[model samples]
Target: MIWHLIAAVFAGLGAAGVGLLLRLVSGKRLPRWIVPVCAGLGMLAYQINHEYSWFDHKQTQLPDSARVVDVEKGQAFWRPWTYAFPMTTAFSVVDQDDLITGQADGQRLVQYRRYRFRKEYVDQVTHQAYLMNCTSRETVPLAGEPPRPRTEATQTFTETDPLFQVVCQQE
Candidate 1:
């Protein structure tokens, strides 16, 4: 976070220097406030760029076996620009190499972990284990200390669901 602040400050300073040079080249025709405005715009541009590229940046950090299952785009009233071009604020990933497949009672089951990434002050990551019944198109989280299946929290998915496709594609 401190590094980002430092970079923004440097970006603002560099833009301000450019504004100053422009004013000098124009023989003082440009107003003095132009430098400060340029500096502010530079800092804002840096912050916007950082936010817009966050999803791709996080994706690049994941392994090749990891598949993206879900994505969430955010738009805020304060950031009106986001409504025009939404930014990915959260996503879910599943790794193919970590899947544990099995068959019981003539039903195909797959055990896997779902990794959820949220863009926050610290870039939060929350993961949960799941037992997916591919044959029935149902999934339930393996919760608790011993991680038993939480049937109450079970969810059913359709064939087109990304999570279901990734977890069942191998079988």
Candidate 2:
């Protein structure tokens, strides 16, 4: 965070320098407000670059075995530019190295951790381990509690799903 702040400040200063150069070259013909405007634009440019590079930055933080399963793009009313072109705001990834597939009581089961990354006011990353019943498409959070059976209609474990693809394809 501190590094980002320092980079933003430097970007603003660099842009202000350009404005200063223009002012010098123009021999005071350019308005006085140009410097500030250029500085502000520089700062905003830095921020935009930071926001758009979030996915790549997060990817670098993950292990080599991790695979991104899906990405979600969204538009924010506050960010009007996003309305014209949506940006990747969130994504889900599953680590292939952590995947464990086996059979329990004649039912296929798999255990893996899912990593979710979100870019917002404050970038957030979360990881949760799950025990999944491949046969019934049920999942239970493996957080020191008994495995509970709950059917999730939206979560499909078929070969088409990336999670299934990553796990089943390895075998």
Candidate 3:
């Protein structure tokens, strides 16, 4: 965060220098306040670019095996700018090893995560799935069948929510 602030300051200074040079070259016809105005604009531009590129920048830093599972948008108010801002981009990643090695002994464990971005910080949520071990003395739940030993069963009607269906199913 401090780095970003320093970069913004440098950008503003550079823009102010340009404005000052323009005024001098133009025989001082330009208003004196233009220098500060240009500086403010430069700082704002740098901040905006930093915010919009945050997701891509972070993604580039992740390992190649990381899989993106979900994404969602978020909104917040920037008090200093006096505006309601909408950030439309976010990402969720899952380690491939966790997903592949988790399914064993007739049991499947899954890891899911979600990420949301705000002006102040990023929010992350994670969930773990523990299913019955297949190698254990447990029976598998059959589709449309009665509940078996050590298995929990449920019926999925036509109107069932898709999100619930994905998370609730046993692998």
Candidate 4:
């Protein structure tokens, strides 16, 4: 966080330098407000770049075995630019190396961890564990709460959810 702040400050300073150069080149004909305006724009540019690159940055930090399975794009009324073209603000990934696959009760069972990444005022990361039947594409969340005895016997398949594809695709 401190590093980002430092970078923003430097960005503003560099833009201010450009403004100063323009003023000098124009023989001081440029308005006095140009320097501050350029500095503000530079700082804002840095922030926008940081926000947009969050997914890629996080991907680069992941281990080689991790695979990105899905991305969620959204638009906000407050940010009008997003309405025209949605921005990727969240995503899901699975670590192929950590998956455990087996056969149980005539069903193909897969156990793995699902990671969800979301960008907001503060970045949020959520991890959920699941036991899924690859054959039926049914899922039972194994996060936070303990599994009930009946949950293992019955399978629930939610249609059209990308998570099923992500989980069932694993070998």
Candidate 5:
């Protein structure tokens, strides 16, 4: 966070310097407010670049065993430009190496961990264990100590669901 603040300050300073240069080149014809405006633009530009690069940055930091399961792009009212180009605000990953598979009442049951990443003021990482039936495409969080399957919390995944495809495809 401190690094970002320092970077924004430097960006603002560089832009303000450019504004001063423009004023000098124009023999002071440019308005006095130009410097502040340019500084603000520079800071905002830095912030936008940071926001757009967040997904790629997080992806690179993941372990080699981690496979990206899903990506979610979002747009906000504050960032009007996102209406045209959405930003990746969240994503989910499943590590194949963690898979524990077995047969359960003629069902192919696979257990794995799902890591969720969300970008906010700072990056947040949260993970949960899940037991999925590869045959029926049903998933339930392994929340309790005994890991009982509850019907209410069970979610069914379709064929196209990336999480299902990745884990279910495995033997």
Candidate 6:
């Protein structure tokens, strides 16, 4: 956090220096506030860059074992400015190993995550228990139980108890 502040400050100083240099070259009619205005704009630009790049920055920092399941983008107030355009502030992740097992009871349980995109705010990850039920029509037994052609849909859901909770419930 302090690093970002320092970067912003440096950016502002650099802009101010550029403005001052331009004023010197122009040799006349330069506004005294030009340096301050440029500096302020540079600071604002730094903040905006930080805000917009947050998601990518975070993704870059995650461990390779952590796989991103999904990403959601939306608008948020605060940071560079309250009325700024929308940005991505949340995402979901799952461990690569979790995906190997089709069972929900294991570490592969689906998880939901949200982030507020603030320096002080921490990302939140929540385990989600999906309630699923087998349709009666889908459970019809095969004649003679010889074999059936497998497809993508076939491997997806099984004919287990129609109603089942994915994530275990807290006692």
Candidate topping lDDT:
1
Instruction: Return the TM-score for candidate 6, rounded to 2 decimals.
Output: 0.57
**RMSD to native, candidate 2:** 2.5
Best of the two (1, 3) by lDDT: 1
Model 6 Cα lDDT, one tens digit per residue, 16-135: 998898788888469878989999999998888886787788889776755554566665544435345667667655444332223333333322122222322555555432212123
lDDT of 5: 0.92
The sequence of per-residue lDDT tens digits that candidate 2 reaches over residues 27-101 is 989998999999999999998888778888888988999999889999888778888878889999989888889
User: If both were scored by lDDT, which would come out higher, candidate 2 or candidate 3?
Assistant: 2
Q: Show where candidate 2 strays beyond 4 Å.
A: 105-107, 133-144, 152-154
Candidates' TM-scores?
Answer: 0.96, 0.83, 0.59, 0.83, 0.91, 0.57
Which lDDT value does model 2 have at 49?
88
Ranking of models by lDDT: 1, 5, 2, 4, 3, 6
Q: Between the candidate structures 2 and 5, which one is better when assessed by lDDT? A: 5
Please report how far candidate 3 places residue 85 from its true position, in Å. Answer: 8.3
Best by TM-score: 1
| After superposition, candidate 4 runs with Cα above 4 Å error | 143-166
Q: Please say which candidate is ahead in lDDT: 1 or 4.
A: 1
Candidate 1 TM-score over all chains jointly: 0.96
What C-alpha root-mean-square deviation, in Å, does candidate 5 show against the real structure?
1.6
lDDT of each residue in 1-171, candidate 1, tens digit only: 999999999999998998999999999999999999999988999999999999999999999999999999999898899999999999999999999999999999999999999998789999999999999999999988888998999999999999999999864
The whole-model C-alpha lDDT of candidate 3 against the native structure comes to 0.55
- Candidate with the larger lDDT of 1 and 5: 1
Per-residue lDDT for 71-128 in model 3, tens only?
5556546523324565535655654434322565555533332233323454344443
Per-candidate clashes, comma-separated: 0, 0, 4, 0, 0, 1
